[model samples]
Target: MSDANWKVAAERDLMSLGGRPRLFESGSGSYVTDDAGREHLDFLGGIAVNSLGHAHPVFVSAVAEQAAKLAHVSNLFASQPQLDLAARLKRLAGTGEDGRVFLANAGSEANETALKLARLHGNPRGKTAILSLAGAFHGRSIGALSITPKAAYQDPFAPLLPDTRTIEPTLDALEHAFAADDVAAIFIEPIQGEAGVRELPDGFLARARELTRRHDALLILDEVQTGSGRTGEWFAFQLPGMLPDGELPDAVTFAKAVGAGFPLGGLITFGRASDLFAPGMHNSTFGGNPLASHVADRVLAHVEDEGLLANVTRRGAQLREAVSALPGVSGTRGAGLLIGIALERPIAADVVAHALDGGLIVNAPAPDTIRIAPAFTVGDPEIEDFIRRFGDALNAASQSSETTA
Candidate 1:
């Protein structure tokens, strides 16, 4: 079908999330060709999912080979690829020998699994309350959304899973919440991506670890956006000073780049938490199918073999240093390639539109914050292109703002 026709049909049939969507035809490396045949740099990386960028040989080969060999076998059966992927994730997460994995199809499902774990851990002791920070975004599913704490996302789904509370992300607030000794689990994103890439305060995570340990509450880190080396390290919680030297969260949820554009997600439990879920507690038909598992295994292997984590660190620093000097940029936050550019004025949406017009792809997660999450494979050339195009967009936005003022 023609691109215009596709857009028309989408508008007629699809649910309205925002404005009309842009139709993208294909992609290679760090760029995508839109329906209009314009090659635009994909700095957003499908919201940080395309770790190796679009159509990488490793991703293509794994999908094809795995699909040809074997695909689905219900949870009643296990595949080698599934087992291998689970073992790899456990190692990367530093879950040691006791760690267990529950696979799912997306970030929301991964979080739902974690929520179930919380219930299992809390129910026996009559501790049923779940805690989350303000401005957090877990997922749209009812269980995940209950802890998300966003008004617009939660209001319509009134009468959500009760006993879910939103707290300010401060040690005092956290301490007070657990004072009742009825807290089940506390969900946190080491770096809250939907809240404009905001980072938790220094030492907050370590203190959380201490508190959750004292109260016997599960500390679940949502690495759905920051996992699989998007943040330079394998996981954001693994970053320096995120926690005490030998400490780890009770569970961690992962998705996004772990599949490198394919649909796969999971929750990894550490220590005694791994034994929380008994057999028959949860299952997914396509969660750990050979097709998705093999492809995800290959994506992670490619990231490790290619040293893309180092690339993410270096390229992210370069991009931040360059973009911070641009005309309208007030500052930059976030670690590695998951960057949020703060603007001097609330013109991030205007700047994003201008950037798209200039053949760059970015998005505004907030009125004054522009988010850029390019592929982990990004290097000098991509960084240079981003700086040039993004700078032009900033300049254009500045000019438009001045004219309006």
Candidate 2:
């Protein structure tokens, strides 16, 4: 097995849709070493899922210990870890004492549960239309995909959920959508991750809260990529000016970093929405298994005890400033570790490829935007390394562009 060629083995035994050439053999902190012995700075952080970074001692110990104690128990019977994780998330959400959590396997399932809750909550009021912003990417499941605004991803499965509509993320668009009085719920990402890490304009989210309340519509913040302390806060909606003064979202969805690489996601419902899911309304087999729940709990506890949120804030600003100062970068966007580099030209893909070749991991979510979500445990050294290598990658990309042109 040690001598097995990853590329050849992948091509032979796995699906072709999502294969990467380099086989990561080991990882720690902010770096991963490939089978070929190349150590790469990992800024992608498993697409923002590895909140604490690779092989953190706490994360490893929690999972191992939980697995030994009790890994799975049917939802019919509760586990301590599962219940504790729920309570912890609700507190972090700042929802009222009555707040409730519905656990699922990943972001998609969490959002699917939210959609169901929205439908159930809206049916009695005769409000059925689901509204989404034009640039939102909720998930890939049929229910979540129905609200996702990307036609390229949605068109393949045409004739999606009925009564679904999309509006731009502008005040005017919100006003226009609210005028109809038929919207049941509005799903949005505080920072559009896949659409190039674009932040929802300040005051716009607060205004959405006001409008949704005025219209008796549910405002659901999809914090899948921005939650669990990724944005220098437990949730993006918790950031100042995100919600109306002294107000909270109707519901919020979380995943990715919540489990810190383990498979766990959930929705926290506030106020009356918390009671929308009746008995047997929604459930998951592996949603809140003791192993995943315990791991997530440990991750969250460590996040607080170690003050990773403050670190995220500091590292984010440092990384963004450094990256934005690089050649070919026009600007930077996003908050905390969820940073995006706006390239001066439409060569994000080229930059990403060059960066990978230069032993730095990054991703191009849009033609002109390179996204980076390093681990919460990242330090000045890793950030510095990324900047140096990324600069070289950008130069390489520039050279390639000039040659091609």
Candidate 3:
């Protein structure tokens, strides 16, 4: 099939999710092939969804085996896979003592679950206002959108969940928000993925922890893009620079790559927040099905067994340094494999288009910043190839912009 044929059918059959023009037919490891058989180095990794990259044998095998045995059972019953996945996550989250897991199908739902849990935790005290960072991207749902802080996404919806506020991600700003005394929870992303892979300052996050503790409010960390060893650590909050002395959030939401391309997301709640949800509060039918839970378990095992976190740390440093040295590149930021390269000029869209044409897949999350979330399994060779192609793409896009100007 031709790209044109797929695109035409997509336009007729699918709603606009604002996707790339090309159609990908298959993927393996760190590369994807389009309908025309052109291969592209997929640095985006399905927007940080394919943690183990494409067609990973372990993940494929686990999902296939589980499906053959038992695919799904409603939440009305208990399953070992679901309990096993929750146990693994609880250990990874460092919330084993007093933590529980609420399984959902995606990052947005996980966050939504967290929000509801926080509200429930604070309902007795009349603390219902939710605060988040100004440049965060939580999700597209009405409740998530309320805290997301993007007007373009929120304005069309008009009237989102009430009392959701976005404050600048600063200690002083956080202090001010906490002073209100009615805040139920503060939703923060340890590293804002859609906001150009921006990292919240270590000091700011620490201050948030302190303030939320003092105010008796829940500190919810959205690690949808930063968890599952994507940031060299099990969770970005666990990064030494962020919270070295084993400090943990009240609740942390994770999804994205957890299922290794299958949809899976949930939250790890600690202390009092763990018991917030009662029997009839909230639930999802297909949240922790055996197939997804088993695949997630395999992904977790693959990361630990292969020691991919160390690779992410090494490759991330190497790639950041290489990309920073390129012309038209300003600087780089982010932890581990989640990196953002700032351009000297606002031509990221053009650069992304050029990179795509040159068999690369990168994202322009901001007008002047390009975000790269390669799979944890990416290697030095893939990093080097991306740098070479990205440099060329940047130059081509820059020159084209200059000529047009």
How much does candidate 2 score in TM-score? 0.98
Candidate 1's residue-wise lDDT over 1-405, tens digit each?
Answer: 686799789889989887755788899999999888889999999998999999999999999999899998787899999999999999999999999988899999999999999999999989999999998989999999999988899999888998999999888898899899999999999999999999998899999898898998999999999999999999999999899899999999999999999999999999989999888899898899889999999999888888889999998999999999887789999999999999999999999999999999999999999999999988889999999999999899989989999
Residue 263 lDDT in model 2? 89
lDDT of 3 by residue, 294-336 (tens): 8898899889888988999999999989999999999998989
Of 1 and 2, the candidate ranking higher by TM-score: 1
- lDDT (0 to 1) per candidate: 0.93, 0.91, 0.90
Best by lDDT: 1
In candidate 1, which residue pairs clash?
Answer: none
Q: Residue 9: error of model 2 in Å?
A: 2.9
* Ranking of all predicted structures according to lDDT, beginning with the best and ending with the worst: 1, 2, 3
Cα lDDT of model 1 overall? 0.93
Question: Residue 110 error for model 1, in Å?
Answer: 0.4
Evaluate model 3: give its TM-score. Answer: 0.98
Error of 2 at 269 (Å): 0.5
